[model samples]
Target: MEGIDAQRLEVKKERAPKLPVHIAKEVTKGRLLKHVEISEKSVLPTALDMYREKVDENLKGEIKTHDTSKLRHAEVVEKNVLPTSVDIAREKVPTLIVNFDTEKLKHVDPVVKIALPSVNDVVREQEEFKAGANEKGGMIHN
Candidate 1:
C-alpha cells in the first residue's frame, strides 16, 4: 500500500482597500475637528444632562436617615487616632523590609523611633505640691 503525503499551503496576503486620494487629503487636512463641539445639537450633551438631573434627583434626602452623632464620633476617632495610625504604619514597613539603603536607613531609624510612641512610657505626672487653697470648695492641705 502507498502512503498519501499532504503538502503545506502558503498563505496569500490581501491588499487593504484604498480610499480615494481627495477623501484621504481632506481627512489629513483640518476638515475633521480635533476638539468635538458639544452643543444642544449633540445627542451626547442631551444624554449627559438627563443623567446629571436623574442623579441629582435620586441624591435628594439620601442623608435624612444618617446619624449626625455618628459623624461626630467618626470625626473624634479620626482626630485622635487616624494620623498616629498612619504614621505608625508608615514607620513599620521600612523597619520590617530590612533592605533599606544605608543613608536612608540612618535618617529613617531615628525619625521612626521619635515619631512612634512607646507603649510603656508614662504620659504625664504632677510637677509639685501647691500651697494655695482650692477655689472649688475642696480642702487644701499644704
Candidate 2:
C-alpha cells in the first residue's frame, strides 16, 4: 500500500495588542499666571483706587450708633404680638382635608405600601447575622 500524503497545517493569525493612550501634561501654574496677568492688564490702577476710595466712604457712612432701647422695644412688641387665646384656638382647630380623584388615590397607594425596612428591621437582621455567625464559629460569606 502507498503511504498517505500529509497536508501542511495552516497557522491562525491573531490581532495585535492595543497600545496605551498618551496624555499631555496639564498647564496649572502657567494658566494661573496668565489669568492674573490678564486681570491686572484689563483694569486701570486709577479706577481701582477710586473704587477702593468709594468703598471706604460707604463703610464709614455705614458705621453708626444702633439704638439699643429702640431695638429692645421692637423685640418686646414682636414677642408680645401672639396672644395665648389665639394659640389655644389654633391648637383646637382640626387640619383641613383636600379630597382627590379615586385614580389619583390609587396611584399613591403603592408609594405608601412600599414597606421601607425600618431601623428595627435593620438592627434585628444585623443581630441575627452576628448570632448565626457566632453559632457557626465562622464569618458569614453572604
Candidate 3:
C-alpha cells in the first residue's frame, strides 16, 4: 500500500442486482418515479370541485337575490332617472353645427382681391417720403 501510487490505484463501483439498461437510463434521468410534493390541500377536493352542481345552484340563488335587491333600490330611486333642471337647460341650449363640406367651401365666394404695392413702387414711395421728411425739418409726421 505504501509503495502503490494513489493516482495509479483503480476503484471499482458496482450496482448489486443489475437493472435493465432502459430502466437504469430512466432512473439516471430522474424520469422513473420522480419525487413529488404532497399536501393535504392538494390531495383534498375543494368545495366547488366536490359539489360543483350545488355550488352553481347556490351562486345562482345569490345572484338572483342580489339582482332583486338592486331592482328594489332602483325602484326606490326611480325619480332620479328623470333629467335634472341643469340637464333640461343644457338640452334646451342650442348647439351650432360645426361640420362643414369641403366641396361647398370650394364653391364659396372668391376671397377679396387687393393689389399689393410692388417692391420698386414701395422703394420709390419711401425715397420720396424720406426726402419730404428731410425738407420738413424731419418733422413730417410730428
Which residue runs of candidate 1 sit more than 4 Å off their true CA positions? 1-45, 69-142
Give the alpha carbon lDDT tens digit for every residue of 1-142 in model 2.
1232222211111233334433112342354334444344565579889999999988877665544455543344445565699787676666323333455454444455577899999999999999988898987665
Q: How close is candidate 2 to the true structure, as a TM-score?
A: 0.21
RMSD (CA, Å), each prediction: 34.2, 31.2, 19.9
Question: For residue 18, what is the lDDT in candidate 2?
Answer: 37
Best by lDDT: 3
Relative to the true structure, how large is the alpha-carbon lDDT of every model?
A: 0.57, 0.60, 0.72
* lDDT by residue for model 3 (22-94), tens: 8878877885676889876546777778699788889999887784544543345445588899998787656
List TM-score per model, in order: 0.18, 0.21, 0.21
Better of 2 and 3 by lDDT: 3
Model 1, span 5-68: residue lDDT tens:
2222111112435688887677669757377877676446688899999888777756666667
- How displaced is residue 42 in candidate 3, in Å? 99
* Candidates arranged by TM-score, highest first: 3, 2, 1
Q: How far is candidate 3 from the true structure (C-alpha RMSD, Å)?
A: 19.9
